[model samples]
Target: MVAKGKVGILTTNYYNPDGNRIIYGGAERYGLELTKLLLELEYEVAWWQVGTGWQKEMLPGVPLYSIPETGDNFQTCPRLNQSFYEQAVQVDFAIYFVTFLAYPQVLEKSISISHGIFWDYPSFDAVIPTEELRRERLRRLWLAFNGPRKIVSVDTATIQWATTTWPGLWHKFEYIPNFVDLNLFSPSEQERKDGKIRVLFPRRLTSVRGINEAARAAEILTKKYDNLEFHFVGRAHDDNLEKEMVRWSAKHPNIYYYWKAPQDMPHVYQNVDIVLIPSKSTEGTSLSCLEAMAAGCAVITSYVGGLPNLIIDDYNGLLIRPTAANLTAAIEELAFNHDLRKRLGQKAREVAANFGLEKWKRSWAKVIGEVFK
Candidate 1:
């Protein structure tokens, strides 16, 4: 059990619930869930919301402090208020969720859980493509360098990437897999008897995510197979991509689009026959892929980042190249073979059971215990 001491959770934004906003990503969700778990373990929890409109819909009964009238972007100036620092210092441990701005304030015994390595590599600059944004990234990197405590990555693949890129930080690193709520995402017994094979593509419509490839694959498959339907869920990044995706939807009647709500995801999974994650970039361990697997959806994803670690190809899920042709082929193969889909879906469920909330709780408890000790 966690001792009775104040624990502050630092995150980007906590208002937007799961499956709502893509920018408010999985790290924020994990932070909130981790905070809840820590509270349930009997710890005094305090959250510091740096952005406006973030404190409105926080979990009920949780104490949250909003930084007073600072600039809209608190990440740029995280130390604007001295009172926030004083309150944070009073806590036994501070947990920062991938916030580079909070790095300067992190003291001894503080733990930093990074969802992605934004500063140490050049791939991040591509996402933020502006001179001002690049400057901000550099400033954050400078702050992170002079931070009080060392940061720890959440996954082994991230650790390896960090070690390979910036050597001599191996001692400060540890791997903790991202936690998933098993009860919410567990497989349903209701069999999908729909004649059409429903394929789900639940990923942000970003360049790195390769949503265009998925859309193209859908277009190709729709031309070849009549009984195959493609479903896309999640927010689009830019107006152009959204317009193109919407155009694709108009062109193909079998293609369906939905902006999924968190509460509606379980029911959504029941209708999906297969899940596709055709990410071209080095995707971190994707929660959507895991959630799909947990819901007994046959997963077909590119072998990137920690995907290879989670999905044992042909055992739990299928790993295809990040190309439209390959993805289309995989889809066609699965569409024709119902038994293969069932077997893969069942195995995926078993693999997902290992990543349940209970397992994550135990792992986190051990990490916190060791860190505090």
Candidate 2:
């Protein structure tokens, strides 16, 4: 097949810059899917990221360039953006893997992606730290917004927040939620009948993803119920945090901590009866929540970001304020009430049918088609 044109994607890191190991997470998964979609559409793709000036392959024939640009004052990495802009001159189009990376400058035929509102947490104030810095940040963000032909937002929360922040930028946004592989992540043919109830927290072990709350709930609930098992199946940012989680899990008999690759997650979701997507802040239409829903597992997600968009309160899944107490109570309620769990899980699967991989690909195709045209 003939290629349409070369496309360059700029981001912080697609994989650990120092090594080939992928940082398995929602954003990375989104990037992978986007690249595949572009390839499927007969476009040549290359990826660029802040790295140690090394080159690798993101996929077969898709070059991953590492630009060794460092430090931007606003934490937006404009230097990397500039570096990619300068080096990727041959590319006909560009995709900013992160929305902020398009700031300072962007190519003429380009688009950006907003994962969700990452600064919703209170401590993010320390990043900007002053009114002048905050204003400067907003200014750069506005410039970033202006540069992208269209900003594909993973959730409406980001669009709502962005439009509220800059009242007239609505037309530049595209709402495309994350997707689930319905065929792969469907319910187990026969539900586990061993009488053991498993609750899985299948997210990266980060503070923003409510790892602390999940840990507290696991500690409290595992001690309370004999049939309950709490599984924390994700890697932390560093080896130290991973060790910490393993050590913590060792102290509790019914608690298990392990990490799985992206390909293995569907089986993990199917085995578990309940899934916890208790994100405290900084979330999108979570991939974990959708996968769990597709697997016909009862889901408990916090009422933050795009979770509310996917789950109706007490309808498809349990939506609560992402606290240790709330998570414990929700888990306990579902554990005891098997019928409620079954109903919620079944409805969640039905709802998840709407967000299938094909629908996501079609939505993205429309956006990319427009950009290429």
Candidate 3:
């Protein structure tokens, strides 16, 4: 079927079209995937995001409008851009995957999609750029969301947050879970080398991702078991986070780091016996968990935003508080119990099958089609 029309995806995360996967956040993954789906459905897709950093050999027919960089050199956090407004009006449908960047023109035409808001974070006091700057940026985001034509949240946790926090705009909110590619991340029977089991921390090193806690747990667990290996596979976007990881790796020889780029993650996942997501909150769908599950690795994640929707304690995958002791215990439990890992991993692949790409594509096609019709 022909698509409704041109669809513009607005966000702040840089999209490396030549890269295998989107880095760090759920919003980036959603934006990249949505653009691909729209194009597959024959829609004229235009991707707008801050930063001209990426090499621009985007998908065949898609046009990537790299908005001029405006924020602090250290941060690519959203700010109003005149070009965003000009390009948005040209699209038939607009979707803001990273909703904070939306301005009046973009918001008025856009379906604002949010995983959660700044208030969802336990405390931004520790995250970089003065607390004052963080607060001001959030202030702009607060006013932007109020003007969106419609709202789409990735999980029930966010839907509830919207209804309770902004009751007046509750009528505009809807829930649609994020999608994962089961074909690419499918289960593969693994080969354990030297009886070593791998645990993965796939998220970028950041305060919100609770990297300190996760790195600490790896240290404790590695000291206890000689056969365990841990991989930290994300770019340390912050200097502080990179320093912390460096310190942890120095102390824990078992911890290895890998740069984020296009690579065969399915094979990497097949080798991984477990995937750990320790983000405190502010998760849209925790794409790492879904991808790990789809690849048949047992997952242990925090009970933060939208996690409970994906993992049930000790059923499909494990759940825990984003604490060092709790993560250590969960890690120890799965590390020793080979049978439990096999069972949960199998069930996880089943759960992942539900969020396949085709389903998400059809859903967007229907939703966007109806809105424009």
Candidate 4:
């Protein structure tokens, strides 16, 4: 069925479309894909970013719009002064990246998507928060999510967290995991040759994701074995982290950085033997993990968060503590043994086959379509 009204997606960061293609992490990917799905279903789609950044172009027929930044960028939340609240505003429904950024009563129908907890996982910090800030965040979260709209969590961890912490709001939340196109992400001919192995850090170059630590680990390993090369794909959300990555690449000939989107990550993953996801914080479910798995890369990730749920510690993939020593060891362990890497990757693909785009689309359509009813 064709959607009857325009749908707007509000995001925390001003997403640059033509620049990186897949700009933001999992949430942006979800929002972007959902926009495509809506357009396919004949809905008028409006892509709303908090500010007008580098995005001058949009996906063919979809027009992009910006919300006036309310002059408030408190930690991880974007507070817009006015959004979807004018006589000219034609969007009947809006899908928010997270509940905190949702415009109060701005759309005829509003659906909150719980991708990841921004406060819990700040783009800048690799450290713990102050108690005062934590309390303030909690207050804002209650103000945001303690409303009537249907909320969609990207994974089960989010539902469990919300139910335990927020209690009464459990009835409103829905679990919808991240997905990958199986056809788009699969194995390719091994790119490793001449005793050289490629290890890829696919997440944004953020300290929280352990880019610095990973770089240090890679540098140390390169000193021991010259054929060990490291490649980082995707741009940084944090400037310092980006600079650090560039500097590290300069310092270590074995480490390399791609400032822009490679655009085709499946090919990128397939070309590499290892995929690293050393996140300091939790995710509902990691899209990086799922995608890399589908591409048949030997997956190595932190034991924290939903990673343990996806990886079985050398069963399907390898899981380690998010530390330089641990991550370095995991990479080295997989690199030295080709058979283990192949076995883990094959099993990883088998596991990832369950999370395809078709399943995700049907579930998301049902949840979003429920809003109109």
Which one is best on lDDT? 2
Candidate 1 structure, TM-score to reference: 0.80
lDDT of 2 at 322: 88
The lDDT values for all models are: 0.71, 0.91, 0.73, 0.74
List where candidate 1 sits over 4 angstroms from the true fold: 1-3, 15-24, 49-54, 63-90, 99-102, 117-152, 165-167, 237-251
Backbone clash total, candidate 2 = 0
Could you give candidate 3's per-residue lDDT for residues 6-118 as a string of tens digits? Answer: 77777665554323334455565666677777776677877776655343535677766666665632122444345666757777877776555554345344677776544
Q: Which consecutive 10 residues in model 2 have the weakest lDDT in total?
A: 13-22
Comparing 2 with 3 on lDDT, the higher-scoring candidate is 2
lDDT of 2 by residue, 1-373 (tens): 7799999899897778775667888998888889999999999999998778888887888898898886786758888888999999999999998899998899998999999888899798998999999999988999999998999999999999889988899999999999998988999998688989999999999999999999999888888888999999998888899998889899999999998878889999889999999998999999999999999999999889999989998999999998899989999999999999999999999999999999999999999889875
Off by over 4 Å in 2: none
> On residues 38-102, what C-alpha lDDT tens digit does candidate 4 reach at each position?
87667877766655444443577776665555354434343452544452277777777666665
What lDDT does model 4 reach? 0.74
Better of 2 and 3 by TM-score: 2
Error of 1 at 7 (Å): 1.7
Q: Report how far off residue 198 is in candidate 1 (Å).
A: 0.8
- lDDT winner between 2 and 4, please give it: 2
Residue 104, candidate 2: alpha-carbon lDDT: 88
Clashing pairs in 2: none
**By lDDT, highest first, what's the ranking?**
2, 4, 3, 1
TM-scores for all candidates? Answer: 0.80, 0.98, 0.83, 0.87
